[model samples]
Target: MGTMEAPILTVNNLNKQFGSGCDQCSNPADRRLDKNYCPACGTVYSCQNITFDLHPGEVLGIVGESGSGKSTLMRCLYFDQEVTSGEAYLGPYKEGRSNLFRESSQQKRYIRNHLMGKVYQNPVLGLRMNFSSIGNIAEKMIAAGNRNVAAMEARGSELLERVHIPVYRMKEAPKNFSGGMQQRVQIAKALSNHPPILLLDEVTTGLDLSVQANVLDLIKHLQRELSISILLVSHDLGVIRMLANRTMVMLDGRVVEQGLTDQILEDPHHAYTQQLVHSLL
Candidate 1:
């Protein structure tokens, strides 16, 4: 669904370094084979000057090995972690004028509630296991200003049904469900606000292969049905190929390549990307 139209989300020159940009970090020579780590000063540029755009209804994939900075980038976008330096403008929020990283805490909360929804790699991170399944979804609705309990319950049930969760099981605790069912519940919570942008970080990471396929199918179905812009982070090339229209390959805190998913899979220009592509062959 990518288009030449203005992006729904824009991130320019994003950087997330652990240290204070020490003198050794500034020196290109001190940057070890691991691009993020410095030998002399031990500075870690967890995410190094990343940049990308996510258009309305587009599915953008960030693929990399674990700890390659893709997850760090996702964390920064979700405001779970602060960025070291960068400008992020959500077009559907604040009229795309203010940089998200610079907004006040209250303003950030508003933006999060109104403009974005996120599903973390772990269901525990995204869901309240102690709460009932519908109760978990209700929390997101409550944050978005919904006050009527009946309406929230109805809405939660609808979302649960959409995700293939049984309506009768809506009152059960997520901790009692299978991993796949728990993931579906988490997805329902993320969709509670009907946001224009959704951030998914390795949503299927720890599931079994069959469960992963089913969840991936649900994700594809949601993307088509909702037509929302998606920023998907995953280490699996198969997952990326299955869900992404455009793909960005990250390595050692840097985006080494970006293009259409097929283009990158068929002909990866970067050596790391080539190796990644071949491994799945």
Candidate 2:
């Protein structure tokens, strides 16, 4: 990882909340919440003042239990969900001066199609199950304004094979594939455009242990081979330990601890982080 390199992504004071905040919950200094939810106003803050920088070719893991807002952060970054308030900058986009969260819809779409790729926890969210696996990859390429059909087909096939999808199955729809295979196809599709940033949200969740291991290994291999910067979200510290150079621990929509993966695993400072580390022991 190039710790000294300029960050490919910078996020500042990102926040996402549901419902209009009442007086009690409006002020952060005076707010009282029950695990990210304000009982008085029924407002649920999915993310609060989140900030981080992802360096070029770095794997930044975000680990937290369900409802800890890790997934919400990924969604906001990928523009799958709107941020209530925040700013994100991508070095590969507009010289990193523009706030991604504030970009026009067309510009955001361009960013998604060119600068970033995301693999959702659910294949359904990331893939068109009915389309041919190779077609899914082509879809992203097409979105990025690639109209050369032969070139797209060649690139799509190459990516699928790189992800370990059998060449024979390139034309098959994802719905007929196993969970792990579907994820592999999704990974291939995400990489089709050669995006600089990849957002991976629980990519290996819900698979059999063996299947999960295979997916994780593929991710590790691909990350190294492509030298891509990844923003990975998962509840599994084991997953974080294997792939992340640095880790951030989120709890109740707030980041409680963050540091090198080894340091956090060895000497967790926050109580919640301590619990998470101990559980991995």
Candidate 3:
């Protein structure tokens, strides 16, 4: 919260589905097949309704058990999946203005290029295990229109050092690093350009408690230093409590409860929240 900035991303009433039976494709191989609705259930709300905002310099945590659509929501935001309805006004959706319910391919592309960064739950999914951390980060910078090899490598080394990974290891293959270290490399890659919005999906899921704590501290430090907004998706209530300013509890693809982190943690209103909190205690 060091600087004044507008909301970087907004999503309203977003809906997504796998197969609800609204459209049919004669040839499944066609990538340009038109989709009006669900193809299996013929329903509009095939998945669920989701509404959220990612403001500058804030951390919003989305928490739920497996299959509750947490990952689906992240995928939709990142354009890995499509939204059936609702508005997603990202970097360029509304002529660079704010539009909560509008999905603009142009805006999505702009955000992907200049405003958004994402880290997957498994670092291997985002990081190339076969390449060194320097190579992994350098590839992203090059893809983002940074052509100076020396400059890119310098920046990559800086990023790795910022994330607490020694710059010397930047030349080692990512597979040689431990899970926590690999996750740090993935973070360095995500931070290559310092995007305004960072989407993290279960970043500490497979790590030990000690490693998780270290990673969490690193993220908090970066968030404070960079003044970037974060959207965290996780199934662990403890992690959410530790990191999030606000918490959104999802169930069956829908948000069940959302409020201040302490409010929801101390006095959960939803049964789902209660269940999650009790399990953690």
TM-score of each: 0.96, 0.99, 0.86
For residues 93-186, write the lDDT of model 3, one tens digit per residue: 4454665335467655656655677899988678899998899998878767889999988899899999988867789998999999999999
- Backbone clashes for every candidate come to 0, 0, 12
Count: clashes, candidate 2:
0
Best by TM-score: 2
Expressed as tens digits, the lDDT of each residue in 42-150 for candidate 1 is 7788887799999999999999998799989988988899998899998877688889999998888887887888999888988999999999999999998999999
Residue 235 C-alpha lDDT in model 2: 97
Candidate number that wins on TM-score, 1 or 3 = 1
Query: Which 10 residues in a row give candidate 1 its minimum summed lDDT?
Result: 27-36
Q: Indicate which candidate wins on lDDT.
A: 2
Candidate models: Cα lDDT each: 0.90, 0.94, 0.80
Q: Rank the candidates by lDDT, best first.
A: 2, 1, 3
lDDT of predicted model 2: 0.94
The TM-score of predicted model 2 comes to 0.99
Winner on TM-score between 1 and 2 is 2
